[model samples]
Target chain A: MALRVGVVGGGQLARMMIAPAVELGVELRVLAEAEGMAASAAATAVGDYRDAETVVAFARDVDVLTFDHEHVPQEVLAALVDAGIPVRPGPGPLRFAQDKLAMRARLAELGMPQPDWAAVAGADDLGAFLAAHGGRAVVKTPRGGYDGKGVRVVRDPDDAADWFEAAQGAPLLVEELVDFSRELAQQVARRPSGQMRAYPVVETVQRDGVCAEVIAPAPHGGDRLSAVAASIGTAIAEGLDVTGMLAVEMFETTDERLLVNELAMRPHNSGHWSQEGAVTSQFEQHLRAVLDLPLGTAEPVAPWTVMVNILGGPEVGDIDGRFAGVMSEHPSAKIHTYGKASRPGRKVGHVNVSGFDLDDVAYEARAAASHFD
Target chain B: MALRVGVVGGGQLARMMIAPAVELGVELRVLAEAEGMAASAAATAVGDYRDAETVVAFARDVDVLTFDHEHVPQEVLAALVDAGIPVRPGPGPLRFAQDKLAMRARLAELGMPQPDWAAVAGADDLGAFLAAHGGRAVVKTPRGGYDGKGVRVVRDPDDAADWFEAAQGAPLLVEELVDFSRELAQQVARRPSGQMRAYPVVETVQRDGVCAEVIAPAPHGGDRLSAVAASIGTAIAEGLDVTGMLAVEMFETTDERLLVNELAMRPHNSGHWSQEGAVTSQFEQHLRAVLDLPLGTAEPVAPWTVMVNILGGPEVGDIDGRFAGVMSEHPSAKIHTYGKASRPGRKVGHVNVSGFDLDDVAYEARAAASHFD
Candidate 1:
């Protein structure tokens, strides 16, 4: 019998896992939230992941349990563990990833460089944050925010009051709005056997609160910055005892300070470039880590790889026909389309282009990605 | 809204199409013949391929229709074409592949080389075939046979009558058992627009009537043999007006004659190595051909790529444990498992290993593939 893997959510991450799991001869089952989600490896049971019964039933027959997202409730994870089911990147590490305040605090405790932050309860806490950050700060909710949601820029104390009300009484983390030079991400993986590997830092471009494009090996290929990012990624894997792939989102301040922005405990949107960009894809690495197998090489397949997200724009026309045209133009460009309906601002798919030259590849990747839009 | 591709069968060739269909941003759907079959790309509808209503329903939403095997009933294919649905490598070419005698007749009409063959109804036909070749002949059913099935060696004409009784009512294609030095397979892809390209001729090794391994860029790099095979493949593609990938199985006789052995109209078992062995995988090439898209590169990624089939043997009792062990042993060998149940002599999957040295890589690939067996 194959090792049964129960993924907690159903989306492209689960869908992408289908290929690698099939390649590695592992049968993957999913507790997909929807009837026709991705991850078509084995039979799927549709149910709510937060419901402990649903999760427990899904885990009961599987050899090991992993997740598609970090949103599963702590009670469900605890129940699975109590019942002797194996859950990778267990509840302890997941909690830190689930809550931004906790993640930042944990990183600070480990002597990692990060922007000065404060845990806030309400409007009163906003005043304390602004006073310490030159009358301006970035306020974010501790949980359930992604792609720039549940976040706000507060220039005045009066502005902070609206965000506090909008948060709906959720805990907030306020940080200094540093003058950052660029945004970068360090993608890493750690196995249960304590083996860890890190990829080069990637320079990221953000557009309207979502990742627009990523240039792997970063621009100019800064040796010092790459080393620091690698150390930070490795440190988090050891410090938090994370098992499976972990990606640390970072902001490079003008003064060369690498502030830890977010921690994702699975293959992230940032690592999508590695599909054809690297020798060992992040999806394959995730499987190896969770299964406690020896990690494959992480060398880049090409000198440069540029990934551009296919954000759904304001259009109701045929996206498929447009994609055909893009493929006709650049037959070598690799495109991954999620079986998703197009909605304005939604992440429909992504295109990655690789070449000996970065500028050439980035242009082709960005053009193809936005062609449908 | 991607182009929906409906494959008529649910075997590993259809399973391999999942990867390239995903990479190329096309929707690939399969009408699998059985449950738990490995076609993991798009939605699969399980039903009878021979039933018109069942097959029609599977073809309902698909833009282009193709096959996982060439054995779809002629009446069923004609009905689909009558309904104006596009079937790549359409019924015309499929007929030659479906029946060996018809294929040989067509090849003979085209002045193609072949071992002495005769269409026989009974012992009388076998008598004529054997009298010309030392009173020994090989008999085969004209249709529905592959990998040594429906084929037999007969040394006497009287024995042929008993063999005919054994075949029930199937017609026979008898050939003189020629002295063959090696076997070669030429994989080629043709677009509906008449574009075509061929990969290097690959030498295949069969053990116990099953393809055990394939050595790409066949040893000694026989340019003459390569050219003859490519010419024959292209001739067959154009002569039959094939609109998708075609793999022409050939036997290189001791006299240097390349004789047609069998034919497959889809991305076949022989071309599975092209997934990582060639620049563009056979799956991707098949998709382009069916869709009439421009052909991609067909160059080898490395100097040598050896693909070894995994045929389950008695030692397959602990398949999962063996797979894990093989992965740790050869990290570079690329193994593709079809997520299928393994019985004795069943093709579970194949492992492809590519490197600078053919001998070492071929051994490594075969070892990794056979480890589970």
Candidate 2:
């Protein structure tokens, strides 16, 4: 019997999964919004993500419902779960991911360490948050923020005063712009049967607020930090009853404290290192976890693995030369190109390098993954 | 523009090439017997390998001509080349691969060390050959023999009564049985531009005339054996002006001699170790070599890597349990299952495992790939 998986979006993550899913004999059905999308499964039923009827019908033919993105409406997700479809990171848990304020409120109740934050309804609320944290505070809309979009460090309330008035009217979250040393992410997989596994915590570098690179085992390594991050990731999965892959993006502060920055319940870009670095690639592990086919080994293939994101900046034209140079120079580096068109700051692809010298690989890996237009 | 690859056969090698070709953005077009074959480029023109007209038409559309098997008639291949299609391992070179007598003649002319051998067309010639190499000799059809098929060992002349009576005369080759300790394979890739690269010699174990397992960086730590085998493989590829992959199956004699037994021009089963063990997989390297793209690194990903073939012997039912059990136990083992139905001694699939422990992983990998039945 073939296990059917219905993905809600048609992007590269879904596209990359096609190879492994087909190889594993798993039936992958995609309810993509557009035709000619990468990784569009053969069982694809093209439809709009905004349409609940299309989504529900797509779910009907699948054994399990998963996602390629978190853009689906809560109402649509609830409709699927209401009809008895086994959706990973079920609506109850996904709501926390969709609504940042609700997530902060819930996590606050759970006693997790995040930055000091407050929900702001208007300029007055923003002013109050600014007063509590420093004079400057980071303002983020409760929904639809990714890769630095919908996020701003506003020194004055007048900056987004008019736009915030017309948008979703959803309460915004305001936090102090912490002076962080670096950012890190923890990738974990969980099964409905309560089995769980976590990969090593990796330090991520952000450029223009988008992930530019990641260093595994976190620079200035400490076994305790890995344990702490893994424990937190496990607690989140168990506490939320989350199923499948989850990536908890964290901020490692100057004092060595790890703070939750954001959460993703699918294969995230931060976990890309595992594709060539770990015993099992994050893509395969996500498929295994989603199918409940048993999680794979998470041991690192090398002592150190560094991943660098290839941003589609002004350097896009250098893809060809860079690829050749990287292949020739750092022969050990594993480069993964997403076959995407270039756009400023858009993620086009990435490169991973594994060796004993983590820092050296990180330097070479960044150069390898970065486009040179 | 997509790079066009012309494959000569639509068998499993072509089928396996589809995945990597698609990933590497090569347009694969096979000259198969019929449509609906497993390779990405299934033959659209229904014809025979002996028909030069059909093969020429197939080659016209493809940028480069390679092969899935060595069975294509030499005259047909030469005709296509004369018509100006770039047939890799050109007709003159491929003839050496097709006929054992041609290969042996060339090897002996090149002063390469191989088993003492001779070709016989009749009983008189066979008797003289047998007399020269003891009373016992291995009788082979010289052409159309593979997988322990059509080759036999016999002591008495009466044992040759049947083959001799049937011989009404096709060419045949007789050679002294090699008293070797173990068998090994050296895989190498050569480009049309005269660039060549060789992977470490891998120890291969055959059972029931079929390849059962291959271990890379051959166990017992014989660095000299590996170097010699690699040199021999490189020499053959260069000597034959071969473009694409060349697999040299060699017998490591107890007297410390590496005797060339057979050769495969395309990606061979022996190179499966590159999937997980080497920095670049053989499939990927074959695509690169055929496309004239710069080759990738051939360094091993780990110190030890083992590969085991899954022979779907007749009468074995229910492979799901064994597959799932192995997956559950060895979460890190890279398994490749060709979606072929179970049949006696068929090459259904193979499992490649890599780690620090060669013997332990080899044991587990063989167990996982072998039939549970």
Candidate 3:
């Protein structure tokens, strides 16, 4: 029988895994929240991931369980573990991904470098954090925040009064906003048995707080930074007991320090360039890791690879409608689209270009992605 | 709406297409001969492909109709074309692939290089052809032949008397068995609007009349041979008005002459290396050609790519059981399984290894594929 993997979300990450799953001869079943989600083709069950009964029922047939997102409630995950289901990135490590405050605390406990942060339960707590951090800081909800949601740059404690009310007595995470020269992301895959592999660090560009583009191997990163990024990524993967893929979003401060910015326990936007640039894509590596299979090599296939997101898709039609223009203009660009409807500021697709010349690769990726704009 | 493609057969070719279709955001539906075929994931309809009504019904909702293999009856294909369904490599050209006699005649008419051949109705006719070709020749049934089936090498006319009887008055194709140094295959994709792109010719090795290995951009094929191979592939595609992928298998003779051996109107085994080695895979190129979308570049990502077939999987368990060993030993090899039940001599999967050095790539691919044996 083929190895069966159950994924508990129907977003693009799940959709991307379908390709590698099919190629690897692994049966991937997705528990999608709705009928027409991005991973609908592989969705075998439609139910709320929060419902232990639903998620457990879905995981019954699969040999291992993974996730497309970090939103499954701790209780639901614990229920699966209690039921003897192999939930990778089990509730133990998932707690950190599901809650920013937990991740910050865990990183600090592990002696990992991170921006100074504090758990602020009230206005007074937040005011004190801001006062010690040049009167400016970043406030974030401890849970349920992604892609700039539930995060804010505040100059005063009063600026986050509404969030504090929403938290309802729970502490929110507040951190000093470090002055960074650029944002970089490092990814590592870890198997349940402790095997690990790290992809090269990449530089990510964001617009409106959403990932706009990514350059693999992070241009001008040099040997020290690359080694440091990989070390930090591997250290965290081991410290958190993270199985499957872990993407560490980090800040390269003006003072040459690499500080942990965020943590994602699933395939992230920053690793998308690896789909065409690396020996093994994160989607494929994630499946291998979660299954406890040996990890594939994470070497880069090309010297440079650039990825540009096609946010919001085309203005009038689906992303497919723009294939002709983009394919003809940039034959070497690899276009990947999420089966999603066009909506302002929504991520609908991405283009990847890999070659020896970084400039040409970036230009081709950006030009091809522009067609979907 | 996403562009939908309907494939007439549910074999490995169709199964492979699903990965690219999902990644490209195109909807693919397949008509399988049975419930649990290789392409079960995309098989929307289960019926006989030779039945015109069944095929037509399956093609109703798709934007374009294509094939996983060139075995769909001419009548069934005609019905699809008559119904105004966009059938890529339409009946007009598919007839050449369906009948070897027809293909030989057409290629001769087009002034192409091929083995000297004749259509023989009885032993007497066969005897005459064999007497003139060094008393040894190859005889083949014009229809229903694949993987060395329905083909025979005869030293005397009486050797093929059984085949002559099976013909029942229809003529069998007889050809001079030319001595060749090696075999090679060239693939070309053509759109309905005449756009064309050719992939590099690759060398193929046959074991027990089945393809066992392939080396992309065939070693020792200099600029002149490469150009000639591509020209022949494109010429045949254009001459036959074939839209989608066309594979032209040829013999590189001892005297350096390239002669046409066979034709396949769908993605063939020789081009499988492209899935991981080339910028645009044959499966993806086939989809683009059939949809009339601009073709992607058919450029190799590495200096060399070697592919080895995993015939007749493990004697005890499924291919998945061997992943740990193979993956651990050869992390750079890309393995692709067909999700088929293992049977003696069946093509269960393949491994692709690409890198700057051909020797290492070939060794890694072979080592990885050996795991399945």
Best by DockQ: 3
Which pairs, if any, clash in model 3?
A: none
What's the candidate order when arranged by decreasing lDDT?
3, 1, 2
Candidate 2 chain B has its poorest 10 consecutive residues by lDDT at: B36-45
A203-289 in candidate 2: lDDT tens per residue?
A: 888888888778887877688888999998998888877788899998888998888889898898988888778877777777788
Task: Write one digit per residue (lDDT tens) for candidate 1, span B173-203.
Answer: 8988878998889999998889898988898
On TM-score, who's better, 1 or 2? 2
- Ranked by DockQ, the better of candidates 2 and 3 is 3
Give the better candidate number (1 or 3) by DockQ. 3
Ranking by TM-score: 3, 2, 1
| lDDT tens readout by residue for model 2, B1-373 | 4468888777667766755554444567777766644442234455687789888987887888888888889889879879998888788778888888899999888777788888777777778877777888888776777889878886665556677677677767788889999998999988888878899888889998789888987887476877788889988888888888899998889988989988888889988888778877787778778776667777888999898887863355556566667778877777676655667778867888889887788887877665444
Model 1: lDDT equals: 0.83
What's the lDDT for all of these models?
A: 0.83, 0.78, 0.94
**Tens digit of per-residue lDDT, candidate 3, span A1-373:** 7899999999999999999999998999999999999999999999999999999999998999999999999999989999999999889899999899999999999999999999999899999999999999999998988899988999988999999998899999999999999999999999999999999999999998999999998999899999999999999999999999999999999999999999999999999998989999999999999999999999999999999998987668645557888998999999898999888889998999999998888999999998887
Evaluate model 1 with DockQ and give the value. Answer: 0.36
Candidate 3 local distance difference test against the native: 0.94
> Model 2 lDDT vs. the true structure?
0.78
